[model samples]
Target: MRAMAYESYGGSDVLKEMRLPLPKVAPGEVLVKVECAGVNPVDWKIMAGGLDALMDVVHPVVPGWDVAGTVVRLGIDVPEFAEGDEVMAYARKDYVHGGTFAEYVSVPVRALARKPASLGWEQAAGLPLAGLTAYQLLTRLDTGPTDTVLVHGAAGGVGSLGVQIARSLGARVIGTASPHNHERLRGMGCEPVEYGDGLTERVRALAPDGVSVVADFVGGVLDVTLAVLRDGGRHASIADHSVLGSGGQWMWVRPSAADLTELARLADTGALTVPVLRTFPLHELPEAFELSRSGGAAGKIVVRP
Candidate 1:
């Protein structure tokens, strides 16, 4: 199998295509023939050794966690799926290696969910990590029909999903993005506010009495969140750990088949959608990493294998 891997932690320059043996399936796992892999900030961050303090990384690491693919073989005791089943997974293992950036990846059955039939391969591939992050944050905040939710970085991958999920829960959403993306946010059922100077005032103008929930996908907006959140409101951030000291939860997404199934249901019903900003062939992972690092794209970056 041909895969992109980096033997040492570095930048996109370290990623190179190489031929590797197919991974062996372990009990409670399934080997998937990769159709598409989602490129996330974390992928490149890990590549640059940003997560060295938290997670262990193995050498010759394949750096992707989100995948949409078909099962080619099932490991022992995996009774929920058979060969040729279409699935998507947040394929993060207990360690970093054998990831989804390859032609084939072995995913634990616990992390696998049936891919939403309504989404294309690229969209399905984009769903797991970003969608799961958004879903999990909103769930943790206990968002509801009457809540007014504020989403930071609302045009980016996870933030876009956060806006839609908030709306699907019947909450009125206020999303912050650049002027160019405001229309896109409005189309997704959010009241769009431009981020930067006077962000608190802008969000306040929209919510007036203050929002009932805040989901910060972009870091360093703690002050803006505190200014616009109602007294005793719930909040969480995937990017900011400081939230933990301020009565808000700091979240790290956990893989859950049940949650992925709900996201699939939402997609199939037209309540949720994944936007692909660009697609690159598996071999062009270096370019993909460069794009992801530049952070100009408004949607998910996908690599088709």
Candidate 2:
């Protein structure tokens, strides 16, 4: 198998294509022939050793967590799926190694879900990490039809999905993005607001009583969140862990087959969608990592193997 790996933590420059042995499938896991791998900011961050204190990294680390592929073999006691099944997973393990950036990855059965039939391979690959983050945040906030939800960084990967999921839950969504992305957010059933000076005022103008939930994908917006949230309103952030001490949840997405299945259902029913900003071949992972680090892409970056 060929994989993009870095023996030491650094930048995109450290990533290189190398031939490696296929991963050994453990009990309750499945080996998947990779079709596409989704690249997230965390991928580049991990490559740069940003998460050194939180998780252990094995040398020659393969750096990707989101994948859409086909099962080639099932590990012992895995009765839910068989060979040749189309699947997708947020394939994060307890440690960092043996990831979806390779030609094949071994994913635990608990993290696997059937790929949504309505999405293409690239789009399905883009869904797991971003979609799961959005879904989990909204779920933790207890979003409902009666709520007005505000989404920060609404045009980016996770924020874009958050807007759609909130809408699907019957909540009225207010999303912040640049002027160019306002029309796109509007198309996703959100009232778009530009993020900058007077952000609170802009949000207040839309929902005078203040929003019932605030989901912040962008960091350093704690003041904005506090300004626009109603009393006792729920709030959460994946980027800002400090929110935990301030009466808001600081969330990290966990792999869940059930939640991924709900996202697939939403996709199949046209209620949710994954947007792909660009695609790169497996060997061009360095370019993909650089693009993801730039944070300028309008949607998820995908690597096709």
Cα lDDT computed for each candidate against the true fold: 0.94, 0.95
For residues 1-305, what per-residue lDDT tens digits would candidate 1 score against the true structure? 99999999888989999899999999999999999999999999999999889888888899999999999999999999999999999999998988999999999988999999999999999999999999999998899998999999999999999999999999999999999998999999999998999999988888899999999998999999999999989999999999999999999999999999999999999999899999999999999989998985899999999
Report the C-alpha lDDT of model 2 over 114-181, residue by residue, as the tens digit: 99999999999999999999999999889999999999999999999999999999999999999999
TM-score for predicted model 1 compared with the true structure: 0.99
Model 2 — TM-score against the truth?
A: 0.99
After superposing candidate 2, which stretches have Cα over 4 Å from the reference? none
Return the TM-score for each candidate structure.
0.99, 0.99
Q: Which candidate is the best by lDDT?
A: 2
